[model samples]
Target: MSVIEEERVRGGVFKDINAEDEDQQPTVIESLCMTCYENGSTRLLLTKIPFFKEIIISSFTCPHCNWTNTEIQSAGRIQEQGVLYTLQVKTKEDMNREVVKSDSASTRIPQLDFEIPAFTQNGSLSTIEGLLDRAVAGLEQDQPIRKATDPVVAEKIEEFIQRLKKLKEVEKEFTLIIDDPSGNSFIENPFAPQKDMALTVAHYKRTPEHNAALGIEVEEEENDEKPGSDLDTMRNEVLVFNTNCPECNAPANTNMKLMILYVVNCEIWRSHRRAGNQNNLTDPSDMSRDLLKSETCSVLIPELEFELGMAALGGKFTTLEGLLKDIKDLIVSKNPFMCGDSSTADRAEKLELFGQKIDKIIAGEMDVHIILDDPAGNSYLQNVYAPDPDPEMKIEKYTRTFEQNEDLGLNDMKTEGYAEK
Candidate 1:
C-alpha cells in the first residue's frame, strides 16, 4: 500500500475572513455650471460633461431680485472602489410692480421649481469571484479532509461551501438607478447604465474578537465658496465710465447707463455676435441710423438711464468718418500728436491707417467687407482687391433715308420734280 501525505494550506480558511472589512464606501462627484443673465431673467447652463464617480454642484444668484439657487449632480465610480452621487436645487422669484385694476392694485408673481438628478454606480461580480477564489484556497489548505468519515473535516468543508455560496450570491453584478427629485427615471445607455461600478470587500485575517480592538475614523475636508462672488469680482474689475456734469461743471457720478451700454456692446454683444471690424460699417446709412436709434441702444447706470439719439453726419461723428475726425480732433485738441508725445502720436497715426483702409473699402477697391466679427466676438479687419470697370464707352448712331413725290393737293397746276440734291 502506498502512503500519500495530505498537503496542508497554511493560510486561514473562509470562515476567518469578514466581507464587510473588504467593502469600500461610496464617494460624491461634482459638476459645475456656467451661468449668465439676460433681460431680467437669469440662465444657468451646464458647462462640462458629467461622468461616473464624480459630483457636480452649480449655483446662481439673480442680481435684479436678489434671488439665489444652487444645483448639484454626481459623478459615479473611481475604480472598483466607490460609487458617486449628485444634487441640484434652484429657486426663483418675480420682481415686478403691481398694476391698477378698477379700484384695486393687483400684483402678479411667478413661481419656479429647480431640481436635478441623482447618479450612482454599483460594482461587478468579478470582484467577488476574486475574493471567493482566495477564500476557497485558504480553506482547502487549512484542513486536509480526504475521507468523509472525519466529522471535524466534514464540518469545516460544509461551512466553507456555505460561505462561498453566500459570497457568490452577494457579488453578482448590480445596476445604478438615477432619478430626478420628481421621481422621473433617467435613461441608461446601451440598455444599461453608462457608469462603471465596483465594490471593495475588506478581508480580515484575524478573528472578530481581535478585529474589534481596532478603531478607524475618516474625516473629509470642505472647500466650497459662494458662487456669485467670482462674478462680482469680474464685474468690479471691468472699467466704468465717468463724465462731467453739464449743470455744475463738477465731476458727476459715473454715467452708469453709458457704462453698461459700453459693457454690453464691447463685452456681450460684440462677443456673442462675432462682429469683425469695430470701426467698419456694414451699411453706412444703417450704421448712422443705429447710432442715433434711441430704442436700439440703452445705457443703464445704477439709478439712471441715458437714451442717446442716432449718430448724425456732422455732430461729433464716431463712425469711420467720425473716428477719423475724432482722431484729428484729439490731435488738435491735445496738440500731443505732433509734439514729442510718441505714444499719443502713434495712436493717432494708427487711426489714419485705419481710416485709409476704410476709405479703400468704401471706394469699391476692396471686395471683402471692411468689418467682420470673429467667433470670439472680436472685430476682424480684412482687405480685398477688385479690378476696375472697362474704360471705353460704346455708342450707336442711326441715319434715315426717305423718298417723296411733289404734287399739289386740290389745285396743283404744275408738278415740280424735287430730286435729291
Candidate 2:
C-alpha cells in the first residue's frame, strides 16, 4: 500500500517528514452523529487491545441537542464463548475488587434473590459496591416503581435496598455471580481455584435464549454459520428457585426432583403427614390452604441435563462441570436415601450401569433430561420479559385441592373429636 505523507509544517519539519517514514496516525473517521444527526460530530477511534487485537471505540457529542454516545466495537474477529465469574464477599476488602461487566453480563446475588438480568444496562467497569449502588439507582429510577399500585412489592423492594446497604455497611457475606455470553465480563480474583484464592471462576456454554437477547443469534445467522442449535422457542429461559422443601419442610435440597426419590424411594411425602403437628399456629383448615398456592419455574441447563442429587451444591450453579461433580458423587457413591438399602444387594449392577450413562451426559457423549416436580411451589421459572424461556425447563405445579386436603387427614374432626368450624 502506498503511504500518504502530509507536510503541513515549515521547511525543516517538511524535510524531516520526507526523509524518514513516519508512523501513520490512527485514521479517525467521521460520520453523521447518531444522537443529533449532525455531520462530523461523531468520531470513531481505532485502538489495539491486549493480544494485539484491534478495536474501535466510538464517541460522539452533539452540540445542537447536547446528546452524547459512546460504544466499543471489535475490529478483529470476536471469540464466541460464555464465561462465569464468582466472588465471595467476606469482608470490606473483598468488595473492593474491580469488576468489568459487559452490557450482556447477568449479575446475581443468589442469597438476596437479586439479579440485574441481561440487556438492562450498558457495560461498566466498577467495584462490587459500585455495582450494588448502580442496581439501587436503577431500581429507584424505574418508572413502574414510581407508579406501582401494589404496596407489598414496593415494600419488598425497599427491604431489598436495606439488605444491599447492609451488605456494604455490615460484615455480611454473600456471593457475587456474573455471567457473560460474549466472555468479556470479569471479577478481579486470582482466576484460578488451585491458587487458593477466595474466588471461584467457571466458564460454560451460553444459552440460545441469552444469544437471542444480545442480537448474537441474528448476526451469526446472516453469516451463514450456525451459532448453535435452534433452541426450543416454546420456553427459551426458566428460573429455578431455591426454596425450602414443601414436604419435609427442610431446606436441605434445591434443583431436586421427585423422580430421584422414586429411584430408591422418597421419604418426604410420608414425613408430610406430621407437618401440621410441628407448628399448627393457624386453623388446621386455613393452614392447609398454603399448599394450594402455586408458582411456575424451570431450571435452565442450556447445554447438558443436570442429573444430580446434591445436598450441598446450593442454589446457583454457573457451570455444568461443577454441577456434574456434585451430582456424580450423589448417584455413583452415596446411599442418599438414608435408608438401609445395603440389606438388599440385587440393584448394585443396575446402579453401576445408570451411573455410566450419567458419566456420558457429563462428558457430553450423550444428552438426556431429568425432570423435577416440586409440589411446594418453592421453585419458579419466570419469563416476565423473555418471549421464550427454555424448553428443557418445563415446570408443572400441582396444588392440593380441598378433597386431597381432606384425604391428608385435615377432616371435620378436630383434636376435641367434634365437628370442625
Candidate 3:
C-alpha cells in the first residue's frame, strides 16, 4: 500500500475510536441560569450546605456574563455519581476471602429428671377376676370363709382411718341459749351426747336482786277521737247561694262567695274535728237543714263585714246597703237566671248546710274570725279575689299589646285593656 493511503486509513480508525469514547463517557454540561442568558461553561463544584444540608454550588463562574455567586440555588441534598470501579473491586475482594477461627466452644446436651410412683405388676383384668371369684366362693360356702384382703384395699382403709383421726383432732363443741321477756326460752347444744350415761346431778340456784333503776314502766294505750269524724259523713252535701249585683248588672259573685265558703269549711274541718264530741252527730239527717243555716250565717256575716271595710277603703261603696244593691244589679245583668233555677236553690241550700255543719263542728269553741286587711273600715265593695296571682302579669300584658298591634296593623288605632282577671 502507498504511504499516503496508509496514513489516511490510520487517521480514519483513530477518528472512529474517538467517537466511541465520547459516547461511552457521562455527559457533563454547564448548569444554566434560568433568569439570564450566560455561557457558564465551567463545571459546578456542588456540595451540601452545612446546617441546612441542601444542594449548593461550592464554586462556579459564568464565562460570558461573568456572574459569580456562592449562594445555593436549589435547597436539597447533592447526590453525586458513585465510584463504580472502586465499589466493584471491594465487592470482589469480599467474595474471594474466607473467614477462619482458631478456637471454638464445645456444646453439651441438657439433662432432666422426673419422678413416677411404683405400681403393682398384676394385670388389671386378672386382679379383678380373682377378687370376683373370692367373693363368689365366700357367698356360696355354707361355712363362714374369710376372704384375704388386697394390699391396695388395706391401704385405702388405712387412709380412711387416718382421715377420721384428723377430723376428730380438729373437732370442737359449742352451746348457745336465748331468753325472751315473755317467759319464752331457746337452747342449743351443737355437740349432743352420743350415748346415755348414769350420773349424779346437783343444782345451786341464786335469785338476782330486782333493781328499781333498771326497770322501765310500760305505757298504756288511750282511746281518742280521729280527725274529720264529725264532717266525714257530710262529703256529698254542700250549700250554695245565688245573688245578683244591682249596679253593674253582673254576676253577684255568689259562686265566688261559695268558693270562699268551701275554703272556710276545709279550714274548720281540718282544725276542729279532733276537739270534742259536742260537734259529733249520729244522725246526719237531723243535722242537715239546721247545719246548712248556721254555717252560711257564720261565714256570710263575717265575710260581708270584711267586704264592707274593703269597699270603703277602695272608694267603691260607702255602705253595706249600697254594696248589696250594686251586686244585685250586676247579677241581674250578667246572670239573669242565677236565682231562678232549682239547681241554684239546691246549691244555696248546700252552702247553708255545709256552713251549719261547720258551725256545729266548731261549736263556738274557737272564734271564726274573718281575716281582713282593714279591721275597722266598713267598705261595701272590694277588688276581685284570685286564689293564685300570676307572677308574669306585666310581661303577659306587654306580649298581648304586641299581638294586638300585629293583628290590628301599625296604622290602626285600638285600645288594649288588661288581660281578663
Q: What are the lDDT figures for the candidates, one per model?
A: 0.27, 0.48, 0.25
Task: For model 2, give the RMSD to the true fold.
Answer: 23.4
What C-alpha lDDT, on a 0 to 100 scale, does residue 122 get in candidate 2? 75
- Order candidates by lDDT, high to low: 2, 1, 3
Q: What lDDT tens digits, residue by residue, belong to model 1 across residues 268-380? A: 32222322222323444422221211111211111111111111111221333343343334323332222231224544465455445445544445333222212222221
State the weakest 10-residue window (summed lDDT) of model 3.
100-109
Rank candidates by TM-score, best first: 2, 1, 3
TM-score of predicted model 2?
Answer: 0.38
Off by over 4 Å in 2: 1-77, 143-152, 190-196, 214-421
lDDT comparison, 1 vs 2, better candidate: 2
Q: Report, for all candidates in order, the number of backbone clashes.
A: 50, 11, 38
Better of 1 and 3 by TM-score: 1
Candidate 3 Cα deviation (angstroms), residue 386: 34
As a TM-score, model 3 comes out at 0.12
20-88 per-residue lDDT for model 3 (tens digits):
243323224577754367656444332221211222233446766677533223322211110000111
Name the better of 2 and 3 by TM-score: 2
